[model samples]
Target: MTSLASKLTVIVSAAFEEAGLPADLGLVRVSDRPDLAQFQCNGAMAAAKVAKKNPRAVAEEVAGRLKARGEFAKVEIAGPGFINIDLTPEAIAGHLSAMATDARLSVPEMAQGETVVLDYGGPNIAKPMHVGHLRAGIIGDTLRRIMAFAGYKTLGDVHMGDWGTHLGILFNDYIRSGEQDKVLKVDLDDPASVSALFEDMSERYPRASAASKEDEALRAQAQEATLKMQNREAPYYEMWQKVKAVSIVGMERNYGMLNVHFDLWKGEADVHDLIPPMVDDLKARGYAVESEGAIVVPVKRNEDKKEVPPLLLVKRDGAFIYGSTDLATVVERMQLYGPSKIIYVVDQRQGLHFEQVFRAARMGGIAPDAVELTFAGFGTMNGPDGKPFKTRAGGVLKLEDLIAMGVAKATERLNDANLAKDMPETERASIAHKVAVAAIKFADLQNQRQADYVFDIDRMVSFEGKTGPYLLYQAVRIKSLLRKAESSGSETRGFGNTEIQKFGDSDIPLALLLCELPDVFEGALNNYTPHLLCEYAYRLAQTFSSFYNSCHILSEEDEVLRGSRLTLCTLTLAQLELVLSLLGIEVPDRM
Candidate 1:
């Protein structure tokens, strides 16, 4: 369905075109100042510049032409040269009827499709997922949902960090096999075992990474073990499999808790076999050049360096860096998925690295279209002293701990409110849990993804202001009112059997607010801004509050008036639920 703004734009364009003027001068928009009218057109100013006429005269002439048609409830020329339009009651009522029935709420889906690959939440295999991975998970998941809503074919790839130099370090440490006097071996199933393995590996890897720290025979054995694992050999591959399985299981718990799910979980190991041919192809095309003892792609460097740092495809010792493997993966994706755009949701600190990879891809001529790479930056969750967020024990905080804290606070708030004391304790607890999750998601989403925000549970769980709980509260309140009306036999009658009440006889705040739904969805889709829906939800809540306060739903003396208000309330609740759902929030029946 065409929005009111678009319809007006078309009408205005035709009016000017009929007058022998360019159509570009015609534009319509929601009013910046609501006191003037519902909509305002600045086309007179643009038209006057080309028509060689006075601006006020042009506006006056257009207003007269529109006035003769009687399409607007009120039409006037204001200021220097603007046409203000007040939609008639009939027009608003008609539009609202159309919106109430339209399932998409006038938000159009894309007619042309684009393929997108979103790479996010790149966590190493041996390490615990931390706050550092938060932004990628949230932002990328949100983007995936938005793009799908916009009618695009989107694939979310959790590019697991499974293969890298870290493999070599782990291999060396395991092969040492000396002084193995511990009575119990590390178990991957237990959290403590997993934690200790990571802690011990982190402490030992840097020392073993040095050339002089190990004998030639030990280094050779390490390399052999690394190759065996990569080739899926027995014992070595079995051990690596256990590590990958355990880590992935742990990571899935985090994603599930966050309401994040990936369409694909392709790992670096999946592309390892293709790396050799990719390097050969680069050599054949001269994109790979011999530099020093290693094969590299010589890149431009800063003024401080006399020699440009090569991409380092092959180390002097014939080892592949991540850059080479990534280049190979790009080729594989181009062949397998054939995406129009590739969006990497990696960290902003890797900006230079993506630049190198993109340049190398263009040089390789593997893609017919330019690959679009996007980087998202995140700030640390700071403590009271403004450093990285940490526990009272001065250790890194786990993602689970943060979620648990938010839920605990939300439960406390629910108990304090004493909401639904009649309901079972189990049900109340479940409702509280949902509220907590919604609160955390809403707080994280309200801010711009690029900026860092303080995750305050107290502020987030409040049932007032622009918080998620506030929106949820409004929804539950509407449901409560409707349920009350239903029990009292005051629910809205079918439209055909009901008489539409006069607009001026009662408050029309909800009607006024209803006009903004199409505008809100349009803004969100175009700008990729869910906050637009957040604002719309808050306004709808505020409008409902005003209506509830000033007017009586069940106490109305006239049947039609009460019925109309009931209809309005029902529609308002539907819209509130719709917009909140789009923001990835759900409203509980009570509280």
Candidate 2:
């Protein structure tokens, strides 16, 4: 199952050693100029610097050694020292046969038993999810899928903002609005009651927060309520639980629509108890000091080019802040999971905040040096005007509303294309949902994580061009082709037959691209970039389209050629499905 490029590197590396040159200078990659070669090795250029010999002379020596192996059809020196290699048709057929039989499509499991923890989903308890939460969920979920596929044990945590002064604000609002009787009488098991209570609370919260800024007395009442909840006072504690329960139900529904799930639904409140001891440990170890009346962890270093403020652990009133809970969450995760790496997928704007937290963790000896803490920061999703996305009315659009808009647009596109009109209404609806989800996820993931992207649903849902729907359509086309082949009794299972007489010009490019799938996975996993996979999927689909249009499969008189072409189609479909699945996109069997 070794990739063709890797196999070639091994052969060439041995050649370098046999020729009395450094074996490390034998790196081989897919040729940038496919018009001349299928693979290229520029190692001779670097080797010339070490051996003080002519690069062309070194390349000539390597080429001579390679020609004797018979694996390549052409071993010629191009330019000054570049080695251009063309594998024989038999060699390409051999590798394709092996890939067709392997279950993992020749991609190896690189991470084995390593453990990774992925943190995302930063929605607060009382508020609904907006477009701001979209990138983190999509990117983090894709990374988890990629890591798990690479053979790592990944733990995805929602890490919600369930505990804060916001809860106290909501509670104070509930009391002042004369709805205290509703909190006492509401049954948590009744969905109607819970839904109504949350709706009312959601509406009142903004009013309360705005009023608190103007009314000193109202602000003090909110502060007192916050203290009571933190202290676990009877009435406040009960109210907090009710609010948490109602909020989680709504949160799950919204997240479910996006097909985003988490193994840990933990939040700041989960680590509240650990904060006191963590702060005490930091203070005792001299990692924390009192700044005024508040406890803080001074993380600034002498080497820092810019000033970094201390991580606030406790406010002057003895209430914990976000840094305290985040630090405690790290301790909890390490104690429970013992992960080798913990990755935070948050907004890039919070880069300074994470820098301080990671530094403090290292200085306090809480996160061991062996464990890596990574901040996979991402940029914002903007509107057409190059600002953060908002509704037409300038309000933050809820995540569900955005999804609905996509689905509605997708349905309209389906109708315009006159697709799936004969299917049952339920099936067509399912296809639209899948298409919508794919469009939204792909539009977000296709951009580099650190770059801002415009959210355009119209462009994303198109069935042509580099869109998710286009990929899905191509996959469905392959499935239709396979069905026709089966009906005509064409041999589809003998992909291992290497006795084919010839390969179409287009066939080789598609096959060569198939061999690069593992390398693409490696690049994305190492760099934490899902857009690499997106680019690969698009190119693969486009390549297959060219191959299909040019190569005659069902009408070919040669049985061997027909079978070979069918095998290529089958492999392309499987790879397309695999890449899309890694991006958390679902492909319907028909649409």
TM-score of each: 0.83, 0.95
Which candidate should be chosen as best, given lDDT against the real structure? 2
Query: Clash pairs of candidate 1?
Result: none
> Candidate 1, residues 295-325: lDDT per residue as tens digits?
8875664553444355777666666667877
What would you estimate as the lDDT of candidate 1? 0.70
Please list the residue runs of candidate 1 whose C-alpha ends up more than 4 Å from where it truly belongs after superposition. Answer: 47-53, 111-114, 166-237, 292-317, 370-394, 452-463, 491-509
lDDT of each residue in 1-591, candidate 2, tens digit only: 667898899999999999899998898999999999999999999989999989999999999999998788999898989999999988988888788888898999998778899998888887777888999999999999999999999999999997788878878877777776666667889999998887777677777899998999888888878878888886777888887888889878887888887889999999989999999999998999999999999999899999999999998888888899889999999999999999999999899999989998999988999999999999988889999887788877778887888889878876776666677889888888998888888888999999888876567555568888888989999998888877766654433343434577778999899899988999999999999999999999899988888877778776777778878888899999999999999899877
Error of 2 at 53 (Å): 2.7
Window of ten residues with lowest summed lDDT in model 2: 492-501
